[model samples]
Target: MSGAAGGALAGKRVMVPETRELEVLARMLERHGAEALRCPLVAIIDAPDPAPIEAWLRRFIATPPDDLILLTGEGLSRLQGVAQRAGIEDGFLAALRGVRRIVRGPKPQARLRAVGLGADLSAAEPTTAGVIETLRAEDLHGRRVGVQLYPDNPNAALLDFLRGAGAMPDPILPYAYASKEDDARVLAMLEDMAAGRVDLAVFTSTPQVRRLSQLAVPDRLRAALAATRIAAVGPVVGQALEAAGARVAVMPEDSFHMKPMVNAILAAIGTPGSGEAA
Candidate 1:
């Protein structure tokens, strides 16, 4: 895992906009001989109030939904954490088991498996549209679908799609994002991007793109990003960058994760056939 030997990303300066996995990602990049600039623009935390989540769990325990959709593994873990705090861990797990489960991606699927549960349906692509398209193939007429959501993104399209297909949609948002506007370090990072000091910019979530735009000024950020090699973790993140008018130059070919994304970044920088930096 050491980059003392020859590595594809040797001596590259890479910008990482991650919060929870900041140290892990930084270590991974450093292992590949890359100078990892750790800048987190947004911080995700459990919702200040747990009343809504508690209500959802109570209703779920009373009458489980016909289908449960998990969008993020973080949301699932957060739900369990809240349930444990409320002393309803066993009940909540039982209620979840009563209904069919659907996962948007491998992360949530892995989370379910960790809890001895499995997804009844899984999206081929790890995006909101992918979840909708995957569910469209099934018959959800008059069925109740409970959706687990993460911070910042509401994913209204999925709910609209479910309603259009004659299914009732219930959303449970367990987390919320608080901007790191007060952090002086973020301003320095923005200045670095503006000066083209960062060689490559890596994004794991759409909110990271929004946070950068908010802090760096969208037009200025867009201009600065033009010269930077932007690497999105997956299509959803790529779309977010593209929507913000940033050119996304790299993404994973198959699985969407930190290691795969690092390899994708290496490939984009002319190091084709490079494996995980770890």
Candidate 2:
């Protein structure tokens, strides 16, 4: 906290997560004197039930396609566990061995390499637009496309677009979101926000936006969200914030991590702290 958030935030309190999962980020914020709000926005869950995914994995590995498109590192990691559990890791890799792998970014690429799969292509920009361009560039039209998707990915639109362009897109969803379950607390936070009790907000994933939207927040709170400057970790989350009408004020260029995200936020606020450029 002695750095930017600490240097400039020694007196300002910012919200950290209450779940204690974000202890690292929270401590950094606290160092800056910023109050860390510990309320969690969303909880990570395993893919819904795993039964359906097991069935899909069985079928997919039985007759693995010629291409594998990975949309997230987490999904790939989970699929590895599912594969190992089914005693089909060998079969899965055999089916995927010669197949071309398309990853959304570096993280997924690293995951694929760990599984002994080589990436044939990775989205240069890490967004839907980047995916489409990569697909087009690789002449993926009419080829079997397998996509590992996030629980709340808005890839429905991109899938539709791909099919319209004559590409066969097979999207395998690895997870589903069960609401955050802290409904009353989220509502209260929304109320406090509307009352101008909160200062800033941080969004790390797109799913958080959909989760918040499900609350049917009051018009005034929504308005306050629009007025409040938001910190986003990456393009996908930024797009989600935009969809929810939050004006994004800061973002990092590469990885969606706390350090860079906090740096971006500090710069945007012109905070005289450790991260602000001289």
Candidate 3:
């Protein structure tokens, strides 16, 4: 969609943390006439070791699980890339076709479609709790469930729930977060927020919040965040921000993607007494 000259976000400065779709988000914000303040916070990279991932793929091909839980589209894509490089893409896809695919959100569902597949079940709310709630009614006793996990998050709650339900939880990590080398950039962004230079700070992932909390002192981070309005892409990210001691001022009511998030920003800014820049 073309942004109007008098767009809703005209003259707004929105802080966007680094993510796989950084440019996509930045362009979307800029299209609406907002200045996207790009800050590098976290980087995603292929798993440092591929042997375990290949082993998991081989095992999966040998004995297709009864259910598969895909958390992020990135994890699935990374696994597919590894399978392709190992000359086992066909086997992997074939095995995948035999399983009941469960997805946490729309991203994994979209990735499934990319591979000529679809989700058999989707979480009701796109969060870990949502996934558990969706599967609460399923007969998981002694069932083999393969879970695709992202970097740094162990997701103990999901695993424990699966075990409690008598399912064999097989988890794999296909990607990892890069080391924190962008501390300076994050610090600069924090500085900008503290100085009231940023109109809104947008976060799309939990890791970004963690990174910011890690680099800045707690009181300082909270103080800096208080200077700007915070928008989280969804409830999960919103919870993380809150847990980190920042108040979330904007979030989409239904959808949690970037486009919906932009609309939320617009809606918040257009509201009377929303504290947006004049």
Candidate 4:
């Protein structure tokens, strides 16, 4: 059910709410015969106040922690950039290498590998639950753990779990979500969904779902979701869509990446199923 070659999603209008990979995602859909709607709801930006990250780096350099948890590749890259900006990139990387590294997913793991470092532990499912379960088996008692954070989603559960395991969790939020106030564009997209102009809505991150929900009235968003099928990139995004009262109709079976997500979307479109209840 390839979107190209007049595949399942051929000529279908799909909404894409992503900033980081907007062009790639949209173009991928367009190649498959989808009129990809680009509506970026949130922008990923470096934290306005770099003090926290700066301080964390200073502490990391001074006293390396027992475990370093990397959540997102972007966060790791941002950390590297911050370190480079501070003229301590070499020291920062060295300090990170001194500690045991645990990665939440493949992204962070890849980032580490790109820098000639490797993760001691990697989450199997690449989610917060996976991270917690993986850490649950480890001996974290009286250990200091530094965590690199992603934007918008505050992983309180992971932190609480660490604390419960007698580990000191120090999280560094490397980025923050800045709202994209293109009301005209967003409203038009929402209206298109409500009018049944859009056939699918693709969400790559949870923050996009939250920001979209906040921008439009709940009832309107709910109605639009009811009319159109929704596709999430992975379990995390799917859960977010569900929480926002959007029925997630498609997701990848494994490997929650853009290619897999596009394939899953096409498959779902080809073989329509009884989508999850709204």
Candidate 5:
């Protein structure tokens, strides 16, 4: 079959969850003839003080720590820029000279490799739960660890989880929020959804769900989300949608990638699938 025949998102009205992933996804949507809407729920920024992070790198000059955590691809990308701004480019490279980096998953690992940093380890799953599980198995209780945080500035849940799991190593957030930027299309997308102009909405991140709560979308627009067909790529995104009062229309098995998820949603819209209460 051709791409359009195999792609579920073909000609469907869709919503993008975050600005970071929008351009590429939007292009993909268009290639499939889908009318994609842009609505970024959160902004991602460089961490504060490129200096300390650079300094953090110095300690790794020789044999970098046995392990480091790469939480998000966005975080990893920002860290590189943060290092450059702090004039610690050389130090940053030295610190990671040969140390093994444990990224959240394939995407983050891909980012590392893109920057010439090879992955030491990558979590089996894409969620925080997967990261913790991998860390636990590696016995991080006493090892000093580095972490890249999420854009929303979530309260160090990973740190707490590590400590609770008997980890005593220092977990530093090196960079704080400096790369923050909201997706400009959020409100318009919401309006479209509210106007019943959208047939499907796709989400890759949960922050999009949280950010909508912060938007000034009228109650009617919010109600529109509840009535529209929604599809989340994974459990976390689905949970966030449900919490926001929008039921999930489809979450496919195994294929968490955006294109596949949309395909699954379209398949289900025409066939029977697991749909949450609206």
Candidate 6:
């Protein structure tokens, strides 16, 4: 999908709830002449204790699971950091290279590329169900599988599926979400949206949607979301927003990424010259 041209979104007020690439998303909107309301909802941090992560890395290096499922780019990146800090970066990378890497989405693929690696299998839908579907065709009986997980979710579904398929799943959570600190800011942003100040509210991760839902009452949250246009980065995020009683007005049909999401946003709210809602 093509991105919006410079000045396309002039006078538009787009609320961004991203954390990791808050500036990047803001600049993308700014480049399109939109005012970016930066309200980061969650902060990604390393696991509070590194001992468990270090142990996982050591076990991974020693055994080298036959299959490694990467759920998020941040998870892989965090694992890499933990491995480096433990002075086992090479061993970790070597073990990673030995396994067949399966990615849930393009982000994980991008992360793999950063480490001079690539995904051997990619989910068709970029969701947990997609991951399960992708692995369904494989011969996983008694296979050792390493699962990279993120914060807040234990992904019992994926683990149960793996166990049902007779695969031994070893899951590792290398990072955690620090979102409690941002509750006040997120609630303020919700109030802004409720007041019809925010033209569009963009969500890039499920955690952002969850955080908003957690901070606001259901009726109030739904009312606030109804006052503004909502844009989701992918189906997963879109589903999360929908489940939270918010309608997703904009989303990329194909590539689920930042640029595609920007393009979708531009399409939903026409350019300045088109005389749409800003």
Q: After superposition, how far is residue 73 of candidate 4 from its true place, in Å?
A: 1.3
Ranking by lDDT: 6, 3, 4, 1, 2, 5
Per-residue CA lDDT of candidate 1, range 1-278, in tens?
Answer: 33434556776778888888888887877776678887876787889999999999888888899999999998999899889999999999999988999999989999999999999899978888889888889999999989997777778888889999999998999988887546567767766776888888889988888877677667776777886789989998898899888888898987888888887776677355556566
Off by over 4 Å in 2: 1-6, 16-21, 94-97, 113-118, 164-167, 253-257, 276-278
What is the Cα root-mean-square deviation between model 2 and the actual structure?
A: 3.5
Question: Considering TM-score, which of the candidate structures 1 and 5 is the better prediction for this target?
Answer: 1
Which 10 residues in a row give candidate 5 its minimum summed lDDT? 269-278
- Per-residue alpha-carbon lDDT of candidate 3 for residues 1-278, written as tens digits (9 for 90 to 100): 33335556777888889578888988887777778887857888999899999999999999999999999999999999999999999999999999999999999999999999999999999999999999999999999999998877899999999999999999999999864446777788798899999999989999999888888999889988899999999999999999998899999998788888877887887434333222
lDDT of 6: 0.89
Model 4 scores a C-alpha lDDT of 0.85
Sorting all predicted structures by TM-score, with the top scorer first, yields: 3, 6, 1, 4, 2, 5
lDDT of 5 at 154: 55
Question: Residue-wise lDDT of candidate 5 within 197-220, one digit each (tens)?
Answer: 888787787776776766645475
Per-residue error for 158 in candidate 5, Å, reads 2.2
The local lDDT score (0 to 100) that residue 123 gets in candidate 6 is 94
Q: Which pairs clash (backbone N, Cα, C closer than 3 Å) in model 1?
A: none
Clash total of candidate 4 = 3
Collision count for each candidate, in order? 0, 20, 0, 3, 7, 0
* Local lDDT at 20 for model 6: 92
